[model samples]
Target: MTTDTAAQDAAMPTQPATPQSRAIKEGKFGKVIRTIVMSVVAIAFLYPILALLLAPTRTEHSMSLGGIAVGSLSNVQFAWAQIVGFDNGMFLQWFSNTLIMVVGGAVLAIILSIPSGYAMARLRFSGRNALIFATLLLMVMPNTVLTIPLFLEVSAVHLLNSFWPLILIFGFYPFGVYLSFIHFKTALPMELVEAGRMDGLSESGIFFRIAVPLARQAVALVGFFGFVAGWTNFFLPYVLLPQTQSSTLAVGLLQMISSSQLINPEEGLNVQLYMPELALAAVVTMLPVMAIFIAAQRYLQRGAMVGAVKG
Candidate 1:
């Protein structure tokens, strides 16, 4: 009877291992290694932003003392005052210029990209593939490579030292066009478009009523990217709008730093600009892009989910 019981117990299968048991059996060392690596990468990316945030809290003189140290709000106020008082508030002018260009360019980019993308994705026509190819080519092309040509063209048209050239150039966003094309081509239902056609709706009617409404996420994505591109663009604007009054915040920041006491102490001692103020300016410049990203985050998330499910 004991030998039979032992044989029956040996025949019975062992229980499957749970995930936790499996992990323990496999050893936790790999997981620990992965966590350590990811933590290091996170710190590397976040440390610069942390330093920037902390720098504005302390005075330049205090910054030389040691590590990132926090000071009173009064230091921030003083930095802001100095920034506002510099050259009779040139920072304000630069801020306004950046706002106008970023907004206008983003809006225009959306307006143009949506329809063009829809047409390319839906309509069959001569040169459609070629046009798509051209767009893809231009999208991959470096902005610096185009700079000299754009400069020459703008100069020939005598539009230098003006906002129109920047606005128009920024509005020409091929990446947005490509993005919209991909969204429409992959995610949008052709059945709906055909149904609208059978109902005697014009292409424009189908687009405005169906396509545009459905593409809100793509539009937001395009607008956000366009805004970021315009806001952060330095080389193009610096070349075209050389005048300080016409400069965007990005270009103006460079000018501020170049003329500041930190860089040229002998000549800039009388200048009110310092590390704290510059850090504050950097923070201000980043705020709009951050706000836009936060606001569009939901749409971006939805878009990603939709894309994943569709294709």
Candidate 2:
């Protein structure tokens, strides 16, 4: 054989024509085992979602009868009607309140986080490192730890039992700030900022015209998460707004459960609360977030995968 052909042959690894080698190469058994494990894991993870979906379908009567029984659409309809009819259509009010807080908080968060992140990443200012460090520290801190201090401040300002506190707190999410900082630091092009500066564009003008347009993915990711945080928030709103009428969906759900009479109808409450009603409420509360996530999934995925390619 020629020297080139000999070199080519030497580069290839020789495999034995044996059963063991064939089995190992094919990995049929390993593939089967992997499939089984993945199936089990998937089932385990999906169980909660499945239960949530079915909980509204199964009746408490059937549950008390000691057997798994699937219910009908009537159960869902009844549950929805009861939930809607509660406290003269209070659920709709709570939903509206939740939408206001979530939308307001998310909008405010996006407005503040983007500019702050851009300033931190690109601007040369005094105490910049300290500001960045403070942001990092706040981001790492547990949200619950800030509740008491926020409560005290809100109380001092007499803003308790209103939507403002929720709006302000959720809008100033440190995680959103951190995400914005990371995106601006790594993903944004500094050359554009420099060009804008050369064209006599002010810092604010550059941010609004250049940075805002390019950072849409990051903004969507931050906005979605911030909205979710506000929507699902329990403690802050609960503490701030103690009244049932002013309760957001999360807190209202808790109120619905605590004030429910269906668990043991001996108390003679007019509205008979049941598992289906609670399940329906839970689904309603979660639907907006789920829908928003599905809609913005592409942007979220892009934001997650970005920043790896630094400008």
Candidate 3:
């Protein structure tokens, strides 16, 4: 054999085949491309966060002046308000509101999605495929389109000012259902389920006792997405709740901007102060989601792997 051919043959191991070796022998170009793409995407996502973090601080004079105008005292004061608090500061209240929405929505979505996903994936019942197709179609539905109907329904029920509307709407996490379904369908083996049946575990018992534990990766994936969606929601809450006091962080920020002069009882350029506070409040509102992701990163990684390997 030629020297190059011999070298290629030598690179091939003389051991029994294994999944790891098989995977390693696959083309690496895709991995290289993914690495490059991920690096670019990471930078793209992080730059804005870095900018927000590095935003100029507000001093007392800046706060007094009300904004961060060049050579203006209010500008400095506004920056300090970001680090500190604004008049009648409701930053913590807004933070609490956002947390309630995320946590409540995530829990409810998980409760419904896991069962729905399992039913769609494992059950051979009538209309199963139809339901799956319908769910897939929901991904294309504009969330904006759903808001008006949801608003009308909430109005009919007189739930406009309450937090229920926000949480409930986010809980109908169709995408999360699809995600869970795909994960459960692909990653779970049928033999294990049959074994559970042969062991005489009731369907419900088997599902909870056997299947649920194995589906951890998918469940975590769904929960993470549902939580994030709940966190970043704006339009549904805005349209549904018109009361300034009843609004979430997104809608509350809108109220602040729209009624800046009217709301600020203090004599300073309150609008400018509100602007900086707005930016600061945005950062505060997003912190929980950031914390959640950081905490659940291991699960997220596992979930991602489950999807990838199954696909």
TM-score of 1: 0.87
Over 1-311, each residue of candidate 3 has an lDDT whose tens digit, in order, gives 12344476678868555667646554689889989999999998987766454333443344466423334456545554643353355555666777787789999999889988888888789998888888877855778888888889999999887888788888888878877887667667889889999999887877898789998877778889888888788888888868765667776766555555435646454335444455555666677778878998887766555434334
- After superposition, the stretches of candidate 2 with alpha carbons farther than 4 Å from their true spots are 1-26, 63-70, 262-264, 301-311
Residues 1-311, model 2: lDDT tens digits: 22344477678758434666545455789899989999999998987777777777767675456433568888888888888887878889899988998899999999889889889888899999999888878877778888888889989999887888788888897778778887787677779889999999988999999888999877888898888888888888888887877889998888788778755556555666787788788998899988977898887666545423222
TM-score for all predictions? Answer: 0.87, 0.84, 0.72
Give the lowest summed-lDDT range of ten residues in model 2. Answer: 302-311
Best by lDDT: 1
Candidate 2 vs 3: which has more lDDT: 2
- Model 1 pairs in collision: none
**Best-to-worst ranking by TM-score:** 1, 2, 3
Deviation of model 1 at 310, angstroms: 14
lDDT of 1 by residue, 1-311 (tens): 32344577788758554678645444588889989999999999988888888888898789888667788799999899988887888999999999998799999999989999999989888999999999988887878788888899999999998999888889999888877887788778899999999999999999999899999878988888888889988889989998889899999999889888878887744447888999999899889988867787887665444434333
Which model is ahead, 1 or 3, in terms of lDDT?
Answer: 1
Ranking by lDDT: 1, 2, 3
